[model samples]
Target: MTFLWRISETNADGLIGTYSRSNGLDRFELRRGKRIEVNEAMPTVRFDGRTRDLLAFDCLSNTAAPLVSQRMAQALRDSCAQDVQLVPARIEAADGVLDGWSLLNATATVRAINHRKSVYTMVPGTQAIMSFRHLEYLEGCLGEHQLARDAEYLGHLLVSDSLAQALSDFAGASFERPEEAYYETMSRRWNSANDAR
Candidate 1:
């Protein structure tokens, strides 16, 4: 299925939530403890027959390109500190906006909708702030497998000063100290996924 990387925000109570997606009405809720954590990973998709149809949207698809939505693209913009043009690398777009984009990675899921999405760019200037994997899909779109790969990739990206700055800009707050609480959540998800594997 199609997937993207994302960063999400939660209310104080951490119940009601929103994600980045093309669909305007897709608001998601997190369980008791399912907030996005720093240096963590989560799945983007599951390979169930019910969702096999979603594979049609995979960026690697040889048929008609998938249709990414404007709503989701807007979410990516909101997640960033400022909008900059993404470079062409693993990313493929003629001149369209970040609105209708999806990733070709194998770890995407089509479960809950995701919001606040953006195409990952390895540009020198932007990379100094945020080190994104292939792309950023926010909210709730991935399943389990995709989450792990994303976390692994994101953790590596965080090692850079620029990535830190980019995350700060996207979150609109300073993340000076590492997120201890987020680490715990990430550890659990990783261990669980590893054990299952």
Candidate 2:
């Protein structure tokens, strides 16, 4: 009963930290579990002009780095200390430096995709997956994890049911039901077919 984040552009109300100035930090490095070196432990970043204020747990625009409030970070530490890395980070708004926040880097990845049971498409000619028509996890693949990433589905950060329940009350959190899948390509194909009509 694991869960994954389902961020939406329509939900955010204000801009969020872009980490634009942080040289070593990026989405790829964090998600890939790469060790990043920063001159200062707490790198400063300002809210970008896009949309969304800091939430208890949130990812930046285009779904970049995962950021969490102190409260949420504590919950993550208590639950999945080995599965994650919470790097010290600072967020700035018009007022000043935001305290009690951290960058979440998921360190544990597993081969959790039950490919035989999951419905997905490969990128036209590439080996990469393009979209999922449905998604399912492999039996017994999660082990004893509070948080994790599926090596077969790199786009998401999955949380064990216990951890998901613990953070259920956090405002602006976006834990999705495990049954959901990212199927953007399916939508586009439908739209293009309609356009031809």
Candidate 3:
């Protein structure tokens, strides 16, 4: 089974309803693909009305960092413990503090993108990747692994087929393979171009 996709989720209003990183979050440290030093205040997430009884898997609205329920975190740990760091995080809701959540921090990066087949570039002297017009992975670049991130785009999460299947039942969580996203992106652009006619 050769399936790959990034885990992305949005609420009914097209926003990441239940999950957002605190303003004080050190996003860079999470991107380093290593265990984060838990500060006095570990990484945290804020929840609002939309989160009531919602599924436990979520991603930070702006950064796309994953936040998972304890069960989801444990699933990852059992499958690919070496590829991820289950950093503790708090889920603060209006009524009270909800517990048993972890930030699914990726710790493995593979430069699996076949540059010639992919259209993307890194900003000068920075890790930020822009112009991801196309993406194509090289054969065998991603070996057997449950979760491996993209080297070019630190925020991008690539999950194996098994992992995707394991998380399939989670409500509000969505995953898309590269080609699926690419086709959708291109189709939208094409429709827009034609609509301008």
Candidate 4:
């Protein structure tokens, strides 16, 4: 499936890219009762991983939303029967730019009924978030290898200056320095919730 990146004015800066699943459907054609043409040239990223694939995109929110991270953590925890713990994760970016960024990582064993573990890492950017995730099933799973490769590819993209430049170029806006305090507060809340569980 091909993913299209479109710019929307949902944020104050009005330059945010949203990733959506495209089925090559044309709104105009459907309205006019015309034959829809499929354009295969659209940029598409194939995910080949053992588990669900993680996609990256710039959200329109002013700051990183805690609900997004919380939901992700909850999903990972729910996937396994054992209690899953999510703590601050250290990210060693090849470019070293992510050294000061807040990262969250978690891993949990699959339910007793299944064999394997689920792993996920999230890197929140000023206006975007990149997640690397995979499930280690017995005998391996389809898309696990692809997920790893995509995570690496996306990790580089997150730390690269070109990503910001591309966003600026496309949105006609500048990247705002992320509010570290906000993210820290969110992290504390998440950790506190984990502790209470």
Which number leads on lDDT? 2
| Model 3, span 100-171: residue lDDT tens | 777777777777777787776678897667757777777666686677777766666777777788877765
Clash totals for all candidate models: 31, 3, 0, 6
**Model 4, runs deviating above 4 Å:** 1-149, 152-159, 169-185, 188-197
Each candidate: RMSD? 18.5, 3.7, 3.2, 19.9
User: By the lDDT metric, which is better: model 1 or model 4?
Assistant: 1
- TM-score sort, best first: 3, 2, 1, 4
Error of 4 at 115 (Å): 21
Model 2 has an lDDT value of 0.67
Error of 1 at 73 (Å): 1.6
All candidates' TM-scores?
0.20, 0.77, 0.80, 0.20
Residues 55-154 of candidate 2: C-alpha lDDT, one tens digit per residue: 4334433345666777778888888788878877777766556666677778778778778877878989888878777777776677887777777667
Candidate 3 shows a clash count of: 0
TM-score of candidate 3 versus the correct structure, residues matched by position: 0.80
| lDDT-based ranking | 2, 3, 1, 4
lDDT of each: 0.27, 0.67, 0.65, 0.26
